[model samples]
Target: MPGRRARRRPVGDALAGTGRFTCGVPEAVGVKRPSLDAVRGFDRAVYVVAVGQLINVFGSGLVYPFATVHFHLQVGIALAVVGLGLGARSVTTAAGTAVGGYLADSVGRKPVMVSSMALSAVALASFAFVPALAAAVPPGVAAAAGVSRVGVAFVGVCVASGFVAGLYTPASSAMTADLTDAEARDRGYALLKFTNNVGFGAGFVAGGVLYSLASVSVFLLDGATSAVVAVVLLLYVPRSDVGGDEEADADVDSSAESGASLARWWAAATQPRVLALAAINLGIAVMYAQMQTTVPIVAKEGLGLTAAQLGTLYVLNPLTIVLLQIPLVDAVAVWRRTRGLALSAAFWAVSMVVAWAADVGVGPVAVGVALVGGHLVFRTVGEILHSPLASSLMSSLGTDAERGTQLSVLEMAKRVGIGLGSFFGGLFFDYGLSTAWWGVLVVVCLGVAAALLLFERSVTPRENGAFGDATES
Candidate 1:
């Protein structure tokens, strides 16, 4: 035993070492806790990718908040048509995420990321010309184009941009996972989240001002940012960050020998732990989706808040996340990820209950706005706790060979959940069940919290091996 070299623990084993199956304890004496300093020691590529993502998401924020307004009001496209375009984009984006994951594992992360960004730049730039293109067509021809040429062109742009955006997600995530070791991965993701929120919050404020002066210029600016990010990622991020090539290729070859690409995807997708994680994440995603889809509507229509007040509410989420994400990451680092996720769900459940009270008029209009603000703050806590831990957990679930696919599955689940939440949130409002909707989500969040605890109990033994039997030192 004296002469033998010690084997390194697997990522799952390292994760399990915090405690034995139940909620995790703090790290043992002398174990280095995760911190901002640890993040500084991460690979150069991690910072590169984070910078690129910040740039890209800022560009997205410039367009995302205004896309419906531009199309439905300024461009004279029907609201229904604009909604259809967004729905189509969601569908295409989901499909692209699956395709992107496969390509990330197969070709490489860098190529997929760069190409997706380039395509997204082109698609976004093309939005500036849609009004002109629609104008060029005669009235008859526009009618024949289905809800006017603007609708057609807008949908086309949405689909193209959404798919490319989707493609970027898994590739970028996998690249980050490749760059950081398991210990540093959580902070690495938190850093990325911080940058993304800062960029997006800034862009949202800027876009609000610029959209009034020269709306077309906003689209062009967004496109320019995407192009800048594309160039940065291309020139800076090393090709080696593509990652898992030899192992991925061997996996492809093995799958090829046994079955088709679909089969290969199915095999990866069907892993019990991956599915379990995805299912849990779906509930979380649905809870989050309500903020984007339902909260503003309730604040405006139900509580009589002005446009500016609603905007402030919308802004609060990213602001909170940008300020607190890193410190929170350090605070939670010693706990088992599942415990963090469960706490996140509890926070979400409380937020939903608060939201219900606000909708039902807990007091004066001022009180309603205050309640809504509290809702956003609580929801932001859940988001901060969930995002990095979920990403880290998903990353740990797969071997090098199928990590991309594994992350992709998680992305797909989020996409589906968001779509479902938006649909159901709207449906309930339309059916005069707005107050009931919050109650329903409260139950969902609590159920998810309980489920996460159970999931942790079941999976700990398999993940940690002998470590599962031992408490934290």
Candidate 2:
């Protein structure tokens, strides 16, 4: 009996012992059972973080959509000045993300998250007081201040808030990766994005009503929500969920050993695949940036639509995401991620073409509405395909020690792309080339799609479709 290699345990029995799969009588009899944990797509810690993010993003939605309006109308600042302030905020946010990633690796994830949220709350609360404070100053002193006090205060708050956002991004992303294993990470990220859109959509509607009834109240409410999220995270989440160097001697040793942290950071930055993915992400981000900046402007001016009509049409984006994102995740569970990304870009390209048609006035009002609706639906599909896959891919690129830095680098690329997109978008519009802008974006998207295919070939076989059930190895 001993020489018989001991009758091999059934696959179901072995897997059940690992606690990764469910075992039933049928499974014990050699049938395979699906994993319940994989189906749920989250552990307890990740769920807590997702809830906090939902609350935080809801607060952001309550204020961000109205930031430019607040600066231009209530504070009596010029549009150019408001634009400059927003640009500055974007730049600072980019820098903040880079710095935040380094800190997330050196310090712990929880500290960075908690501190960022707390600081963001302070900065947001300060917004409500800026107009009042600016008005309180004497007219002569206000003139002596060069730019208006309101502008200065507003820009300062924007800079501060952007920096805090940068800090939070890498920390939160790395924490999510820490809490989720590779198999479930795709669904985890998709669920997070889903919650974000849900929160933003609900807050957007409520913020509109609140802004009309009492504009100042929106800022206060946003700040209060940030405070609540910070508190919830501090009280509920455990530090051990994301490992940290607890001993003072270990920290000193890490620092004393010829800057080991810096060496690791440099290694992460130089990873060929990481850089390639970041570049692709930058291109995607540029395309996505149009939605927030150029799309609305083009929809209104180029297509001759009213503000209300544009808002109504834009609602389709979030609606599609909420209804279809999870189902799409399940539907595409077997897809190679590279193929999914390429397909996403193709969708964006088509959407851009549709947008171009609407901009050029190629049809009547009813036809134009249909074209724009189709454009939104296609763009939303691209986003659904891209976001979760990109996040999961980046998270897979490095160890826990290096994951924060890698994700940060990816985020920085996105921020830079958004800045470039906004700049180029405005430049094109100003130069009376708005119609051509969509065509250019279409080209960019197609190029990205092609590049991703080449990228897929360049990576190792195991890395090509690691997220799906059919890994080559």
Candidate 3:
């Protein structure tokens, strides 16, 4: 089998008097470099696409959390009803992303991406009218009394909106990878994630305010912003002239994929190296999900904290992520990938234990307790370390054109992990005292084990031209 080509070495080539390495294509945002002029303005495109992402995701940050609460209480919607709505939206998003991922492979990353964003705009645009829709109901609903059916109907609207978001991620991630070179990949992805978190934090606060004044306010704002995002993306996002990363002349075995090397995609997915990365992603996302869901439950019920206090802890994370990600990213960038993941998982284990004790010494007053403070630092640190690495590895999955589908599949794996993890964890935790913390501990441990397993098992595999250059099996 053909193997990955040796890495691009500008210095060595220059010393040897080889012009091939001396005058190469310019570097793209997330990739190491590009060989095509079509991909010339990749950096600007990322920002434009990011606008659409932020517009949709900011609304997601606010509405997803609020919908459950609103439906379960304010709308007097049954718990089953709320669960079904949430689950339906999740399935919709998953299906949409899966389809979009394939389309990215078949057609091209840009058209699939821009088209999805446009549809997303339509979905969000409908949200602005939710208030008027709610008003048509009985006085109990319009009056904003407890548990209005009208409010539940609006939650249904949000469910539809979330489906569109699901379709957008894989295409966007693929486009980012397509536009850049290997070296810049991590930074580009980190920047995108940073923007997402910043938007999330602001939206969280804004959602509460908007929802209180008019349940539809958040939707209206989100919808309009999505429209603006679509416009920006259309004007600024690069066209198909831009292709994916440059192929390595040596290791390319282009028989596996369709337009892509199908065998290459197969090798990366099945190979120990790529599979290990997938496992690690699954483990990390599981732990991450618990922080929002289980950890809070333990704090509120077991430790006895008021809703406001618990909420403060939740809100603190977004601000903390935005501030620390830059330095953390830089620091991790200095280390080899293995060292970063090991250090990250080690700290993550500590965060789980911290939750076990957050309520320990505080007695009845939730005010004085700070058990979770340490966990915040650890969680953020772990996230900062893992995110860039994950992005880098996933971006290395396929050539430029196939990047979205490959990455999208990886994302789907992550979502599957998160979905099952939360489901099982919820079942396990609701059974006993401090049960969730213990479960989290178990999950973190499993992540560490998987990371180590991958590290131990990595072996290079034959791949297509572009991906073969930047990544090994």
Candidate 4:
């Protein structure tokens, strides 16, 4: 046989054409099988980042969620004041995301990432150290300041941490894009999302135990992990070239690439389909916010369920992702991106209806089971479909040079979603929890789904770019 074909092809294409094996045997054995390596191969940075994310997310789970609780319970701050502090944190995050994305493109992904993580550790340390400092103040000074000093310091640190996280994410996300080619982007993101959820679920569960032991320990542990992750990125992950390097352009077929210009950024910002997708994502996020707001209150107060039960309901979403993400990614790998997103939005809508019914209480046992089991199953499916697919879409739509800026726009939309979701969810809850969940949220999901499907149809074949559309025909 000839050693070479008439034309060159990618290794994956060559392997697919060969069909030399069936589950480790020759295909003449009466079965044909595809090589798994084609799907499994990825840049080393992907795995390293995945591990770093696991550490950072787990450490975050151990403390971040409980920060508000700590302020309210341990520090004697009012719930309203704690809410204001958190709200301010969200605003700072949005600002940081804008700055980070610009810097990731202008400078380099690694520098921004390492600096952000290091700063995050410092912020967490501030949280850990302030209480101790407050305790040591002279009695006269301590009496004069009371808990106000500690509260002020804690809120300031929380805001700083949020900003640092904003800086870390776009760089990290852009770094993922830098490492993997278009072929591996979906699987790479799926793996990243899976690691994040696993770490988060475990962290939230373990955080309870840590909180019981000592609240201060939570912040200290979170800070330590952030520091470790920063070191790992600095030492292990190979230095990323600045976004416009010659090699990076080769990866994207940079025919469409142009020199750095504000016009390119403006073009990406004004792309109709991209903006539509971002808006749809924002709506979905607003619907999701109810889980943090109206859902838990109704589950506990309306249904007479314990805090443990509500916590279980919350855990199921991440648990499902951790267990099923890879399998689900493989399952939908052939589907068109738009169809998957439409199906996901449908699932989100359905889950909201289930939550609404559960809130009204069809039956104690049945409602509890539906709220825990049904909602988790449906909502997790939406999450599995949406998260990786959206990341891949963003990767596809962007030019190599403008990728960070494009992603920053998407992140900004998410922040808007969170702010709007929290504000509206709170206001509507005053009218009635049922009105809040079913009337406001369920409707938003349906509208977003419809709009997403419309955009799906409008996605021209040419728009598929180097990362071809995977949406079902």
Strongest candidate by TM-score: 2
Query: Between which residue pairs do clashes occur in model 1?
Result: none
The deviation in Å at residue 87 for candidate 1 is 4.1
lDDT (0-100) at residue 463 of candidate 2?
Answer: 52
lDDT of 2 by residue, 170-216 (tens): 88888777776565567778878878777776666666677667777
In model 2, what is the error at residue 428, expressed in angstroms? 2.3
- Model 2 misplaced stretches (Cα beyond 4 Å): 1-41, 68-84, 126-155, 241-243, 246-258, 299-312, 363-371, 467-471
Whole-model lDDT values for every prediction:
0.75, 0.72, 0.57, 0.67
Q: What is the lDDT of residue 86 in candidate 3?
A: 47
Best candidate according to lDDT: 1
lDDT of 2 at 453: 90
What TM-score do all the candidates reach, one by one?
Answer: 0.81, 0.82, 0.70, 0.78
**Per-residue lDDT tens digits of candidate 3, residues 1-473?**
01221123475442222111224542232312212221122356666665666665676656534554445445555444444444445446666766666656555566666677677766765655654566666766535645455555555565676567666677777777665556546556766777777777777777766666676566667666666666777677655432232332336445543536454444434644555666666676666655644565555556655444444555566677677665565434433455566677777777777766663544444432466656666777787777766666666655565566667666765665555455455555545544455556666655675565456444232221122223434
Q: How far off is residue 272 in model 2, in Å?
A: 2.0
* Model 4 per-residue lDDT at 341: 75
What are the per-residue Cα lDDT tens digits for candidate 1 across 310-407? Answer: 55566677799887888787666656788888999999999999999888887999899998989988998999989888888888777865778888
